[model samples]
Target: MGDKTDPNTTKIIHPVYIVANIQNKVRILDGKKVTYSSWVKLFKLHACGYKVLSHIDGTTPPAKTDEDYESWSEIDAIVLQWIYGTLSDDLLTRVLEPDSIAYEAWTRIQNIFLNNKGSRAADLEHEFNNLTLRAMPSLEDYC
Candidate 1:
């Protein structure tokens, strides 16, 4: 995304960060020079349904057949949801008692898979299982 400028209107700015991977490792680009506001915006946008892709040395991602990018995108979305949802739930649970309305809302969101109980539930569960298998300590650990 490129920066845009307008003279007449007030602007809501989003902080941009270059996310890159190197030598099979992922890291934020120019991390030290990033401002706190930018950092917060970067994270907020990421939390709010933005997709961030990783690049190495400005090159296209390592190649795979059609199977790779599609799977990566789905996993990326699930991982992002898990990170943001977990943190939000933790904060809500700590600040509001379990019986509080806010806590109930959080609980409901977390249990959305169960409440929906349809193809969506099956899809999420399948993705979760695949992710769990991939994240296992070893190939023999889980299958």
Candidate 2:
């Protein structure tokens, strides 16, 4: 075969695909913006397509001594990297925990955005103002 290969057939290449697809398709999830839901959905679909959804969805991992645990841990780390890479530095610092796994980090992020409706509302209002300002000639026309 040529240099081309199917990502699923090779574990080594799967991560490359995951990172590229995620970084390219998903925008950086800055807490200041109102893109969290769309970002989550896009990342989840890619993770599921690459068969690593368990890394972020609270799936139980095997014991440290288990043979499968080694591979599982490696994949989990990769998934964590994907999440962190797409996050803004401030938010990453807020959610980063000592020795935390992908699932824990994911849950913390979900809670931060989901429970904080005030922040979301503020962002939506900012977005609405910005959109109208750019789209219309003046405030009266926008209203």
Tens-place lDDT digits, model 1, residues 55-136: 1112243245655765544444443333333343343343343322222333443454235559765876897767866578
Write model 2 residue lDDT over 42-131, tens digit each, in one string. Answer: 888878878888888878899998998978888888788888888999889988888888898899889988898898789889978678
User: Which candidate number maximizes lDDT?
Assistant: 2
Residue 120 lDDT in candidate 1:
66
Find the 10 residues in a row with the least total lDDT in model 2: 10-19
Global fold similarity of model 2 (TM-score): 0.71
How many Å off is the CA of 25 in candidate 1? 25
Q: What's the lDDT for all of these models?
A: 0.40, 0.81
**Weakest 10 consecutive residues of candidate 1 by summed lDDT:** 20-29
